[model samples]
Target: MSRQHTSGDLRADRRYAYAEACLAEGDAAGAAEMAEQALDLAPRFAPAWLLLGRAREALHAAGGRETDLQGALRAYANALDLDPEDVLGSRLRLAQLGVGDALAAISPAYVRALFDGYAARFERHLVGELGYRGPTMLCASIDALAGAGRRFARVLDLGCGTGLMGATLEGRFDRLAGVDLSPAMLAKAEARGLYHRLVAGELTGFLAGEAAASADLVVAADVFIYLGDLRPALAAIARVLGPDGLAAFTVQSHDGAGIVIGPDGRYAHADAEVLAAADAAGLSLRSLTPAAIRRQNGLGVPGRIAVLSPGLA
Candidate 1:
């Protein structure tokens, strides 16, 4: 996912750069023109196609022109054809336009590339600018349900971005292991010296590789937003967790009957669907409490913190 991108022609690259700047400045028409010029020079350049799609999408959003929307979809589909792994997030863009599957919109390549680019200032921006407290709220829920003094022999942190959740439980666990998709974020977490083991992998795959009943606690703070379905992850968690062990996680919640992709591209799972997934996974819920996971635009984002144990439903 950490690969170089270029048009192979300086003029095309320049046009692409200018197109990016134009899009950032809200000049959709200029951006579209520049992106078209770039594509004309380098028809095989996927980034140019992606930029063209974004420019057209902005134009459609402003004017509600069906032609612009159709053009955007065609450009996105072309981008995806050029880069099947979707490192440029063409699938997400298509999903935003309601032209693709929402459940599979997010690609690991895209997430890895995104966090790799944002890793340097991720903590500062997320904690300082976004006012994110997902780790803190998740830890609080764990303590409330499992007891503050409960110490675990082994703990697993899923989507452990920069070791935030691991840092919160530093002294409570004898051994701490973390799994994340972004290598850059894993490097940051490694530098913190909190996790005894750090693996760069997807959450469910990591959990599947672990021994059954190996962990006493598993935590996923602000990670479920990327996953539209929870049944697979919950089933894997139940397999790895000991009978007495517990799993604590948080989800962006909505009032709908099922999961929905929010305008921000994050998945928001309804409370009933979450409970149903846990039940199907043979995990009994200890707590499902409303929480404010973070602040978006200076207002609290609605979420839910769930604590569960491997038990009869």
Candidate 2:
């Protein structure tokens, strides 16, 4: 799950590769068979188990068979047991299927593993393919609120994947610091030379470790989608932000009252919940604008970009 050799058995590895190919080719039955063969040889291989689960999930989606769904659940459960850290995102799959805790927060390991693997082609794919405009949108929002020629003494970029957000805020901040869980992503960000400080750590933990009232602006562009509950992050942001500091972020939004885990393994938060979290965290919600965060399957994904400041009331 950590991008290491997943299977020690050569035959099992081959079978797993074939299973992946089969799934890619839309041969769910063949994929399942191949994954089963791999698991028979290496029962403890988490990747194979995950593949089996995916194959079964595909089958269940097509056939609507309870048996297939149950099989998928078992396979994912086994994978989760083998790797509790959920680097492969077994928990997300379970939640997506509505079989487990629907509001479960994505595992940090999963996010780290995901971005680490994507770090190489991340900007190209996300911005070019998916049409991601989170960084640009956030920067515009900040500039609009701060007015012309406004500059920040200190800025924090939460989940600063490949320094995209830092790059967007280039001339606006005197000092730019970024934090990400993936070392690979941090390496990519470091290569950009946009950030003054680059930290490899979880966003919440990094925020908590910073001195209180230290940051003039804290930004988390498209970062909250991986986190179902925003209260903790909001509180940490509030603690680290100066009295007049602003916290800007974005999230995949839903019409529901709270949160929902989508099939794509991302969390979508409702406007009500966002406001509630801001209130509870002692932050004032300055704005929540509906925007298209990215494109998925040729359509824009519904999301909200929000800005918050220390509460005056």
Q: Which has the greatest lDDT?
A: 1
How many clashes (backbone atoms < 3 Å, residues ≥3 apart in a chain or on different chains) does model 2 have? 0
- Residue lDDT tens for model 1, 11-61: 999999999999999999999999999999999999899999999999999
Tell me the deviation in Å of residue 253 in model 1. 1.1
In terms of lDDT, the poorest run of 10 residues in model 2 is 1-10
| Tens-place lDDT digits, model 2, residues 62-134 | 9999999999999999999999999888988888877777666488888998999999999999999999999
lDDT of each: 0.91, 0.90
Give RMSD to native, each candidate. Answer: 1.4, 1.4
lDDT at position 261, candidate 1: 82
